[model samples]
Target: MRTAYCVDTVRAAERDLMARLPEGALMQRAAAGLAAACADLVGRVYGRRVVLLVGSGDNGGDALYAGARLARRGAGVTAVQLAPGRTHAGGLAALRRAGGRTVAPEDAAGPIRRADLVLDGIVGIGGRGGLREDAARLAALADGSRAAVVAVDLPSGVEADTGEVRGAAVRADLTVTFGTHKPGLLVDPAREYAGSVRLVDIGLDLPGEPDLEALQHADVTRLLPVPGAESDKYRRGVVGIAAGSARYPGAAVLAVAGALRGGAGAVRYVGPAGHAVLARYPETLVSDQGPERAGRVQAWVVGPGAGDDAGTVAQVLASDVPVLIDADGLRLADVGAVRGRTAPTLMTPHAGEAAALLGVSREEVEAGRLAAVRELAGRYGAAVLLKGATTVVAGAGGGGVVRVNPTGTAWLATAGSGDVLSGLSGSLLAAGLSAVDAGSVGAYLHGLAGRFAAVGAPVGAHEVAEAVAGAWRDVVRG
Candidate 1:
């Protein structure tokens, strides 16, 4: 797992390390890493023209010290101090000693335009709100530059904790973060500005759990359910789905279609569309007696074109197994009942449904996805997956970082795609993965399946569901 602590956690860790180490050691480590990354961008340190957009805090200190390192290596380094009076005294002195020229922000435009690289040190974790006038101007200047921009910590003007861009933010080609990743690095709004991220280890030991986490390939491998030699079909667990109706039987078939391809031993589907589901997937155990009589299942997936079938949704939610609520099921839910459920509950909603659940507008959820996911998890007391261009998975209990699905394409936005995801995640839950693991792993697999199904072209819901096994195989093989 690639863990990301919040700003406060990072500060605490930084303070502990700073207290034991010599003064300026941490900053030196940060500066060295920044300079090294810059060297790779320009291909050579010597003879390259480098511009540093210096601000008021240690962020500027980091850039100045890095500028000094480049100057020592024969690079033409120029420091454009936005707040000269507030700049780090030690860093400024070091830059001058290493032969770097200092220029005021007013005189920065010309040189910045002609430079080969621009280092943004206008803000760091301590920053609040957007850039100040001078910093914003410099950001705009850098934005128009031909140079490859590198952000010192995070791009200036983005909220470190929430990934919200307060107003205007610098868009960097690369961001070099210190100690651990911040939440903004993995989320949208801020993530959109942060082009690429590289972490610099400063040996700070963080306390408690991380505020955010991005799963790596190896972590996904460990979390995925793998059948053992001694494992039988019944041992693998079964998933029951309550979906579709007489009018929309395709939803039931598609949901069952995805469940069959999922790593479940068997799928028992109960709805009014039993015939349609069985016709498409003969292996599915189908019943028209509703979810109450669907027999035992390890997990239940409810909703997906369920229409106004309040009775069906109520019956499914009352079950002992973990339940995943989606589509129309989300509409018929009583927030209190969902919160009161004893079994693990997962809520999968697109922006519109998420907005309804939170009593906010769909635009609000889309505008601030990170905040929306956390709010929903906190409100409903369940694992929430807000599906969109960037799928966010947040645990109901506090203290876990949201996992952002980076593999989805707009092509996956077709009708009934979410139904497939609901089925896949429900199957994983039935296979005995925890709610959080089920949602995250399900998202990862769903994205891979979409990519495989699309293959750079448009794809229907059935094709995406059909490709799930191939995607699972690719992940296992890797």
Candidate 2:
């Protein structure tokens, strides 16, 4: 699992490490790592023109010191100071001693255009909102250049804690973050700006649990349900899917498609679209009786083309089994009923659904997904899986580390894709995984499957469901 810490936590760690280390030692270590990464990106540092966007903080100091290292290697390094008077004294002295030159922000455009590389140290992680006008202009210049732009710690202008890009932000080809990964680097919006991330360990001893976690293949593999020699269909676990309406039968078929491959022993489906589901998956136990009479299932997946079936939604919520509410179910399910449930409940909602639940605009949810998901989870007293460019899963009561799914593709944004996810996650829930685990693991597999189904082109939701086994195999193989 990859973990990320909040800015405050990371700052505390850095301060602790700095107190124990010799003066300037910690910055030197960071500068060395930053310099090495810059060398690797540019291939040959010799004779290359490097431009450093120097601000008025330790981030700017890191860039200046790294620029000094490159200058010593025969590279022509120039520092473009955003705040020339307030720049790090020691870093500036080191760069000047190493044959590096400093230029004002007004004269930076020409050098930025001609430079082989640009390092953005315009703002540190602690800086809020967007870049100031001077820094924003330099960021714009760097964006228009042919050079490989590398951000120091994080891309300037993105909130390190929330992953929100409120205003102008630098778009880096790579970001060299020190000590630990910031929450912004792992989530979306900010993640999109931070093209590729490279972590540089400066040896800071961070405290407590991370703010966010991203599951790797090994993490998902361990959480996945594997059958034993004595395992049978019922023993493996049964998933009940109460989905689909007379108008949209494909949702039922798609949900069942995902459920069958989700390591479930048997699938019990109840809804108006039972005939459509049985026609596609003959093995499915179909029933017209409500979820109450759906015959003993370990877990239930409600919603997903369910329309306004509030009665069925309430019935599923009243069950003792772990329940996953998605699509239309998210809208129909009562908040009071959900909060009162003793069993685990996972609510899967896209930005829009989440906004509706929170009584806010969709734009608010999209801009600040981390906050939105956490708020929804706490408000409903359930685990939440907010589906988008970066899928995040937060546990019940909204207090632990939020799990970010790092494996999705834009191609997975098809019509019935979320329905497939609902079934797969519901099966995992039945297989005895917690709401957070089930949601995160299901998202990981679903995303990997989506990648497999759509290599580079568009794919249907059914194709994505079909690729789950391949994704599972790949995870186990690793």
Candidate 3:
């Protein structure tokens, strides 16, 4: 897992390291990494024009020292000091010693435009809001220029802790962060501003659970449910699905389509469209009495095309198994009953449904996705997966870090795809994974499946479901 700790955690780690090592060692390490990355950007740093937008903090110090390295390597480096008097004295002297020149903010535009690379060092973790007037002006100038922008630590004006951009922020082509990853680099708003992120290890040795994590292929493989030699149909897991209706039998088929591929031992279907589900998947055990009467299951996937049947929803919630609520289930849910359930509940809400549940506009939820997901988790006391271009899964109790699904594609937004995801996640939940892991792993598999099924073209929901085995195989292979 690629873990991201909050800014405060990063700071604490850095402070502990700083106390153990010699003074300014961490800063030197950060500068060396920054300079190396810049050198790679401009092949043969010799004679390349580099501009540093220096601010008043250590972030600016890092840029100044990096510019000094570039200057020593025969690059023509100019430091545009935004806060002349407040700039790091040692950094300025080092740059001057290394044959770097300084230019006033008023005289920076021409050089910034003509430069081959720009280093944005306007603000770091200490910054609260957007850039100051002078910093914002320089950022705007840099944005308009053709220079390849590299932000040190983070982009100027972005909230390092929350990934929230209060106002205008620098849009970096690459961000070279120090110590560990920050939340701003993973979540949206600020994440949109951060282009491709590169982490430079400064040996902070951070301990404890991360504030956020993005699962890589290896992490997903470990979390995935794989059958053992001694496993049987009942021993693996049984997923019960309460979905579909007489009006929309396809929903039932699609939900079962996903459930069958979920690594579950068996699937039990209970709904009005049991005949259609049975026709599609002969392995499914059908029942018309409802979810409670459908007998035992390791997990329950409720909603999909459940329509307005509150009785079925109530019965499903009554079960003491892990429950995944999606589609129509989200619409017909009794909030109090869902909260009062004994089993772990996971709600998968698209932006529209999330907005309705939160009593806000859809645009509001989309704009601040991190906040919205956390708010839902806190309110419902359940694991909440807010699906979109960027899927965020927030766990209950407000302690664990929210997970951001990075493997998402625009193609996965097709019809009935979510039903497949609900089944897949429900399967994982039944397989004994925690609700957060189940939701995140399900997204990972669904995205990989969509990509495999699409293959540069459109694909139907059944094809996506069929491709799950291949996706799982590929993940396991890696």
The TM-score ranking, best first, is 2, 1, 3
Please give, for residues 1-478, the per-residue lDDT of candidate 1 as tens digits: 7777789889988989999999999999999999998888789888999999988899999999999999999999899988879999998999999999989988999999999999999888878788888889999999998999999989999988888887878999999999898888877778888888999887989988787776656677888877899987778989999999887888888888878777889999999898888788889998888888878899999999899999988988888889999999999988888888999999999999999888999988876888899889998899999898778899885336788776666789999999999999999999999888898888888898999999899999999998888888887777
lDDT ranking of the models: 2, 3, 1
lDDT of 2 by residue, 1-478 (tens): 8899998899888889989999999999999999999999999899999999999999999999999999999999999998988999999999999999999999999999999999999899998998889889999999999999999999999999999999999999999999989999999899999999999999989889999999998998899999999999999999999999988889999999999989889999999998899889999999999999989999999999998889999999999999999999999988899999999999999999999999999999999999999999999999999999999999998998999999989999999999999999999999989999999999999999999999999999999999999999999999
Tens digit of per-residue lDDT, candidate 3, span 1-478? 7888888788889999999999988899999999999998888898899999999999999999999999999999999999999998888999999999999999999999999999998898767788888888989999999999999989998988788788778999999999888888888878888898889999998989988899989999888888899999888899999999888788889988888888889999999898888878998999988887888999999999888888888888888999999999988888888889878999999999999999999988987888889999888888999998878899974457889888756788898999999998998888888899999999898889999999888888888999999999998999
Task: Let me know the TM-score candidate 3 reaches against the reference structure.
Answer: 0.94
Off by over 4 Å in 3: 455-460
Instruction: Give lDDT per model, in order.
Output: 0.88, 0.95, 0.89
Q: Return the lDDT, model 3, position 355.
A: 97
> Which runs in model 2 stand beyond 4 Å of their true positions?
none
Candidate 1, superposed: residue stretches over 4 Å from native: 397-401
Better of 2 and 3 by lDDT: 2
lDDT at 140, model 3: 92
Instruction: Pull out the clashing pairs in model 3.
Output: none
RMSDs, each prediction?
1.9, 0.6, 2.0
